[model samples]
Target: MAKQEAKFDLYVFHRSYFCGKMMAYMRYKQIPCNTIYATLDKHGSDIASNTGLRQMPCVRTPEEQWLQDTTPMMDWFEERFPQAPVVPTDPVVGFLTRLLEDYADEWMWRPSIYYRWHTKEDRTLYKKLFVDELLGGFWAIGGPVSWLAGKLVHRHQEEKFLSGDGLTKANRKHVEAVYINTLDRLETIFQKQPYLLGSHPSLADFGFFGSMFWHFSNDPTSNRIMQERAPGVYEWVARLWNATSTKLGEVKFDYVVGQVPEGWEPLLRDACEAYLPYLSENAQHFEKGSKRFDWNVQGFLYPGVHVSPYRVWCRERLQGFLNALSESDQNRVREILEPMGGWKPLTSNAHIQSNWDPEGIAPLCKPQKLPLMYKLKSRFTGSNHVRTRRAWMKD
Candidate 1:
């Protein structure tokens, strides 16, 4: 008898950015998987039961274990599959790839959310799409109630990301700047090669694909810009979406490992310039128990941005990776990043010293406190130091 093929079940939503990330990576790797759209009724309940959370784009492995978080899922699959590895083997290139991935995962999220929900056309479009996907055929027959439900769904997103400190008038320019500039830079890269690193897609490609595929390329307003301004990028997104197992294998073998592409440096520099300072300030504020943090990017002040402890953990994770390199590897990475203005933040001590829990619960940031003698000395010296700590929610 023929053996049954191994396969995994992927729970995802069409409009989810992270879901796009996972889908892109899975396609690139040619993993045999079944895609289950996580709707509001029964499939959503199943996902919640499996993961204990409502997070979309989760994978249920053949071992019966359910997993979430696109980054870690990619890592786990890379180890298991070992064919067409997304991460570079060279320490410097690997670290840079991971840094870019982190930037895309956390920083670009603001603009993705903004472009999706901040506009009437895109918001209405997404609401109807989501309603159709979530409610399935009932949406058409339900009539007025379905329309109200879709509106409620759209309003929920607007309240959570649009009306809040997420996409304010004061910071809209900065957010837009990040998206446009990133596209410009990526277009330059794609002009030279098929993928971000070379002929094959890497972690960096999948990272940006999360936002670029779902938000920038799919949203009406942003899609127009992508087609007109960066046709290369739009084409690349299509290529990634339709990649086959044979094509991935061919591209993977065609490229050499440890070789950084031509336009990667400038993109890395841009990420450093745009995201490092924001991350540093976030760490400082989260350490101080503040729910909101603010900073200036590209000479514009973004005030009252909500503090995210999860991002603080991401910063710490980047630092830990940098610190783990061998001395020679670390120096090599520094040489590449130093001129780009990324060295300091990458090497600096995290203001919020924290670690991820074993079971992946809330990451607890350790509070720093002065010794009795130091406190007494500070009192005499009139220092205004105060102690604070907070726990980050599980992503």
Candidate 2:
């Protein structure tokens, strides 16, 4: 066991944000696992045969069990490997950690993609990397086929993500502003503390790592901004990457209202104002079966935001965590979240009728559905806002 062996098969894409999240977590726990590179064409059939979808960052255990979805996958790992835990022990702290984690995991996702493809240099690099990953075995990488593949990916991604997600000239700057504001806040926090909450990396840190490490800090556009603007946050990316569980001491989010880390408020405020509200909108659109609808996140009007059933489930998950809390703990959490504008969304009944993951057996079992579309034809979907099988997509 170099680092720490778990005999786990982690199927991953090098640049996938969720993969980066898993990488940071497994590294933190000192879990030695093998990463098996997976693409829809080469590995889709076998993966879909097991998990019902071809979402990457999915893991195959030593016992040959398949697991998908990072939220539940982390739950599975936390239950199994509770050493040097990233999750807080106290119920109130635990719930808060999960809330921040969900925000970073879902809310920061679009902005992360915005940095990746919107930037000319990073987009070109990612397209080249994508070609090598997908078409490397077909021929010499810089050849005509590779060139065509890269071009196809760039076009497909721009169409599917950029225009499809409604990233327009008017709001593109707003998207970047969100990211920069996050960096500014995080930089301030890291200057005061080693991790987001404290010295040990919490679930919140790993969640942010999904986007920051994989996309923002790595991309040339945001990377430069990070290096110059928020060097502390930039340093944190590597720190978390190399972090070991040995340094993970007692975890705490139980501090009373005034005693909690001051840095958390801004992030949580944005989550309350931006992420939770967006989730509410997504749930509404999903209920209406709208293909795309207009919504303003943090005051930026995104006209064609895709309605995600999965995010509706995300809202449910948050509400579940909140409901499970004791009255006292719930009140304590409210002292923090209520003033920040998050309490209402977690408590309000939006008539969300999603039957997904009913058994609470996530990461152990998968439901028979896809996140966005049930099928997509494109050979390369890196799992941004949509995930599905490519087998029937080409049809």
Candidate 3:
């Protein structure tokens, strides 16, 4: 039988890293797809609300089925299009690639968005005029609509920030410093080779590229810093999106970890270090059973710096996940970073019953859990509470 015809359209934001990641993948594989620009307030106008997550990077399959999130899209793509594989054939490379991709989606995205909107004064730097241009015809459908839509989104962001969930003065500094540190380290790695996994661009490269291209490259404040401090990394981001990487022989895949050029290892270590705080903070929050963060807040925050039940559970999960990996997979992770003292594995301070030691700020009393703006009325059955804030637009 013939291969099935391409199915589905993409609902995306031009500046969404998640959207960009999927788009780059679709482009690389030469998949045929329709594109829709789903701006913030216009969400109700699209099928995104019908889907569980009210988010972009959603896919509408040829069957007219809607799917959301990067991981699910990738899973669908891998099964449907197997000719040009984004996953590596080698197990070690594959595992590491998945880990890096996860890190980018979760840990990196929060701060990246913060820097895009809050870290800078200029709003035009990151807005994509092309997004409106692409949907120019839609304006006829609703001319003043886009302007109103943009205002709603801006208001939404402001309200979320003021809700006092994600961003705090300390966390902002922590995120800013780590964001720069991550780039500095990543730049060194790109300097060594074209892609993170070396010679060949893999799934991980696409994910990281999404974060870099969608946010840093588009935002004025971060973009300027990127060019000034990490020109090579910026160049690599552009290269991956190039139409040519998909075609064979334009770029060869021969880079191996040990064979990588000098100065790359240190950069990676620093990136890893920068990543730890967010990871630790999330784990702590989960354990404390605290809804300290607003679902819409753009960064990580924890009232207490010390180890909490959340951190203990998080560390346990990490250990279990690591233990489940095949020996060879574990060895590969160790080998790649052997130059940087290898994988020491993170420990839970709570489990050890040690005093809390946060990476930044002076020690303080264990803080109280912030009340959630709204709580899930029913656990796991998909129920939530509606909050009453003065500015909250009642639905």
Candidate 4:
């Protein structure tokens, strides 16, 4: 008899965008995994105890190791299961794919959050969904208690997403406009090819699955817009969601190495034009000890956006990846990015701290400055020895 394969334990909720992305990726790769729903009332404590953080879409490896952060998780899994490579082999194409993935991961978050929680229709719908998923049948106990709990959850998310620095009336139009533009561009791509890169799904496709599948395709208002305006993209979301080994096996392996499809250029250009500038400005402000910063993209002003050290770290990671590429590969990528205004930021001489922590539990926008004593101690004992107790505690 053959030995049974060990299945990965995934801690997630059905309606979470990040979780959807992870699910799509794992299913596409034909990885054996089982879902463990992290309900707010029942399983929330289990997740917190396991990871020391409340974030969802965490993975417990076959070896009993816990992992978070979708990007790193994807990388780790790819190394372990090298049969289906989501990352492109060509350096230039790989760099571009990573850029798109990063843009989808960070920049698209604003619109995703806004479209999900800002509108009354969406708020009412998701409140029920959240309550049902988190509390299960607890609403049967008492109407008032269930209603109050649902209302509190809705209000908290509304304040965080709609009223907070993430989304406001001033920038709402800009965010929606960006989303529409992205959908239009993506529709064109899906019309030409099944996936972003080609026949086979890549990191770019899964990156988009995070927002498009869970929020835009699931939320009532956004789903209507997606179905009406960009049915191609909506269908693509469904396809990614239901992807499996059998389905993926039917796709011909026809993706040419080092070739990016023409449809992707416009979307990539928009990312470079809008998100790159925002990231560049945010990094500058973060380094200067500013807690809040903002920037304008395509004549739309976004004011009072909080400085995120985590995002700065993301930018630095991308730049570091570019810098590490061979000169020929760098030049090749520059040719692709230069016309879109991305080359400068991608190759910027910005000072990135070497000792910065990439822990997911770190405060999203808080400065990651080390105390003088800790900094001095790190020099002698190596930076890894520096304690991140305060950072974890902040979350």
* Candidate 1 residue runs with Cα over 4 Å from true position: 135-141, 250-260, 354-395
The better-scoring model by TM-score among 1 and 4 is 4
- Candidate 2 lDDT over 1-395, as tens digits, reads 45744489888887888998997888888766888877665776567666766568888888777887888888878888888777777787778789889999987887888888877888889888877774355522477877787887887778777778888988988888889989998999999888986778989999999989978888898888989999999999999998888775555543444334567778888888888878877777777778789987666788887777778888988888888878998888888788888777667765685555655566664334543353454345534344511212100
Shift in Å, residue 288, candidate 2: 2.1
Each candidate structure's TM-score, on Cα atoms with residue i matched to residue i, is 0.85, 0.89, 0.67, 0.86
Q: Which one wins on lDDT? A: 2
Model 1 agreement with the true structure over 58-123: per-residue lDDT tens digits: 787776667767887787788778888877777778888899999988878878888888888998
**Superposed Cα deviation of residue 267, candidate 4 (Å):** 1.0
- Name the runs in model 2 displaced over 4 angstroms: 1-6, 39-41, 139-141, 247-259, 366-378, 382-395
lDDT of 4 by residue, 1-395 (tens): 99999999887888888898998898888889998876645665455455444457878767666676788678878887887688777787788888999999888888887888788898788777777775555542548866876776666666544565646567779989878999999999888877886678888889888999889998988899999999899889888777775666644434555656568888889888988878888778877888776667787766677677767777887887788788998888888788889888755757854234546432221224445665443222112223423233223
Which should have the higher TM-score, number 2 or number 4?
2
Q: By lDDT, is 2 or 4 better?
A: 2
| Residue 14 local lDDT, model 3 | 78
lDDT: worst 10-residue window of model 1: 378-387
Superpose all Cα atoms of candidate 4 onto the true structure and report the RMSD in Å to 1 decimal: 7.2
TM-score rank, highest first?
A: 2, 4, 1, 3
* Candidate 1 positional error at 45, Å: 2.3
Whole-model Cα lDDT of every candidate shown, in order: 0.73, 0.77, 0.55, 0.74
Clashing pairs in 4: none
The candidate scoring highest on TM-score is 2
